[model samples]
Target: MVYKELTGTSVRLPANFTGKRFLTIIALNHAMESSKPVCSDGITRDISAALIRNVTLEHAAWTETVICQKGLPYLLQSNLQKVPLYNSTTCLSKCNLIAETTLADYFPATHISGSKDHDISDFICQFLPLYTNETLVYLPNDHIVLNWEVEESGSQVDDFYVGLGLDATEKDSPSLVDYISTDRKPYFKHRHEAIGSNELFYIFIKTVNKAGLSNIAILGPFLIDQTPPQYKYIPRVKISEESILFAWESDTFYDDEQTAEINQLAFQFGRLSCV
Candidate 1:
């Protein structure tokens, strides 16, 4: 008669027995394991007064409500015995029956004040477009793709909010009103022109679960570069009888704090016939 999914602070017991008197016991499972000698005489005596109850039934069908603490395992037992009139003693008779059951608290207790301190890092393990180097560089017109992974435990995530700001402090303490709500998809895409150009920005993500627990994750100090490289002066060419030389001057573009160098250069040669 084990109850598998008991939750909250109370339990209802409906019983149908053919006895004049009944004894009910509800105690923590750990306490019951250590104090098994209380029922040595089969009459369930010497038990804690608070954990035991005596019930006299007027009808065969009866309901009893037991109050208990949440988030713990408990053992419940009901014994139907006979009281002899001659000896005035309670004893187990041939018709006596004992029913034992184990009850488990399914829903763990939640503290509203402590929920705000929950570690969001456990919920989101990874965030995309991370700044590995000095900065995560991107072009102004490029679509920024953000992706992440959520932990499998705890309550399901009900909503996601993303925030983009120009400073790290903004990411640390993001305003919910400034954040954009998103679906449960693991990835979100920021379309071109959605963000301003040539600015360093930080990304903040907040996840709220169905239980009202929320956590925030921060990523980036990414840079969006709108300026392109430009030539400082016109190219100069030198031609000799057997060889040719080409040279040009250009302004350096600093990417990753390093001067951008040309990886390759191409040229085409053609012969013109005199008519």
Candidate 2:
């Protein structure tokens, strides 16, 4: 339920980028390039840590553009065709090393404009692709619902989806599950009763600004067995003197270290019927 925890360094972008004006959301879908050793807030942190800052401080999806500046390198739409997104940890943690040059180079001052902004402010862009990676877990019987809270003025979001696919097993594939996005909700749930017992699935969250999924929350691990249950039903007789003795295989114990299931049952029965 926790998102938007920023911990790295950020500087006020050049005045021309924003025209000293309104805010826009930037989502990077790429990794930052730098020759220098990575650090967080200019201090040496984990280089392996990822850069996961949100792109837009305050804005929506419609009013944005990737303006190809004159003679500047443009991001190829075909580049986006390559799947298996940038490498980073799970959702909500860490910073990826970024350089001023890298940021400026990727999102050079472009004339991007839309409805929300009357005047197109020079925008700030990052080197990495934001908002492309989203994660989701679905609950049935109402299946899902997003958090109905607003954090910032521009925290209103609604670009996401949720569906189920069976081919995506093992954590190595682009998950087949999708969730509809909403605003300011740590977790959004818009679908209903979508998961099946036989299906293996994944969920994707939508981000308008350049965002990354970091150290996400953990889930439950269920234990299951394919073997059937073994039982013993016995009847006994009332007797004046009774002594029962039973012995079974000690090997019929289930061990956590073992890969097999073991069960043992033994009983002594005495029966008497009289007229």
Candidate 3:
């Protein structure tokens, strides 16, 4: 007797997540831990906070010294008759090599190389950086009044943008549109836009400098609607002094490993605002 097989629906299995080897990018929770150390630049390892006070707090600037006062001692100590004190400026002061160097034998000192403390800086030279702060300075109302601050400022800033965010998946192909700027500051699409707007839009921003567009600074995907709840006009909003407000016994901020599948289920009704 030949047995005829009857066709039936086979059970479908979930995706094989078990025992699968996959790559994961691990990052430290900066909020809970300290970060790494920093290095310093050479030549002028002796920096004073007074110097920063002297520098302008505007746009980032760089300065290079053709000749320097401090280099004479280093050169004279190194026993080089005529050495160069090449001092260059950069945004940061955490690098190798000396920035300030002296010109060889170009000393204006009439008498063969004068004394050490003979106003070395006066006979030599000095160069330092000056930066001015670039800001999204805004003025809300027009009293036709002037802002005493930034009255004598000079700037060459082109433009700026601000928005919500993008997912890590579509970092390459993003929908960059609906951008707006009025007086250099951006008033683009945020999560707090018209009702029903998505709370996720990439905040890609860049500035067109003298060297073309600078690197796109993706600040954050701020859920702008992350604001706490607000109260509206409720005239009879009376509350008894003997009212008791209750809450759950759990914290919200969690790591992916700790707040896995089963853990998320615990927050089904956890609409908390306070920490």
Candidate 4:
């Protein structure tokens, strides 16, 4: 039996099996258990099942056949429905587009932080189309709006103007709000009540140009009741009777991103004498 450390699953095989066959058996078992047959690594469950179907694996071969026929028939049928087909004419046509446009870095660096009672807002997140040239007048003017949804609640919103208002809410759903600014800065301010543990809210930005074409950008998921980060502590060192001692607060008081500078200052102070 081979044990998988990550998923806590095991695969039992004949004692005679070793090396590549042993590896294959483990991969197939994990795929069956996890249902995630696709992986970045080349060794995936689908590939393992395919090999087992064609090759003879002693006693394991019968088990693989039973699994393929019974355990995965529904999944295989669903997969077969998604296979794309192209005719000779469509495949022969020359493609003009050099590269397809994508929202690779659509998320902004800023994020909303703090608790429900003191919800803090980040500056406006911005996005631009990959293939657009701003200097061209015919490109059309674009307007952005804040969008949000409730996590695990299947609730959605089309778009909202910049500014804070209790615009959208439903039974068992997150209340949708926005903060719009007219000072020429494109950003939305979001605020909400305190959330319980495991509660989540999803927020994003959507843009529509004058041409009526729309594109969406995500700000990622937001969680509630997260422990607020503490301010970093600077350590102080003291030496007496050839023994050295360091002291600092156990609780974090300040929350800043200057960890490197704080470390430098601590090290510099440690090297100095207080006698």
TM-score of each: 0.38, 0.23, 0.23, 0.25
Clashing pairs in 1: none
lDDT comparison, 1 vs 2, better candidate: 1
Per-residue accuracy of model 3 over 1-275 as CA lDDT, tens digit each: 11222234332334333222322222335484533533223111111111000111111111222223343322221111222322323211211224442222222222234423334422333222111111111111111111111111122345543222354233334444333332444223222233222333333343333223332334222222222222233223234588644343334233222111112222222367432
Residue 16 alpha-carbon offset, candidate 3, angstroms = 58
Model 1 clash number: 0
Q: How far is candidate 3 from the true structure (C-alpha RMSD, Å)?
A: 32.6
Off by over 4 Å in 1: 1-136, 142-155, 172-177, 190-196, 211-215, 238-245, 249-275
Candidate 2 lDDT, 123-231, residue by residue in tens: 2123323221121121223343332211223222323322333433322223344333444244454443444433434432233322222211111111122234342
Q: Report the alpha-carbon TM-score of model 4 versus the true structure.
A: 0.25
Model 4 agreement with the true structure over 1-275: per-residue lDDT tens digits: 45444544643444553122224322336456644443223221111100000111111100000001111110101011111112122211211212321211321112122311111111110111112211111100112233232111211222322322121222122255343323322344333443333443333334333223333333222323233345565566689788878677754354232111121123233455853
As a TM-score, model 3 comes out at 0.23
Please write out the lDDT profile of model 1 over residues 214-270, one tens digit for every residue: 666554455455555444455667997888876764443223321224333455556
Q: When superposed on Cα atoms, how far off is each prediction in RMSD?
A: 29.3, 25.3, 32.6, 29.8
* Each model's total of backbone clashes: 0, 40, 19, 10
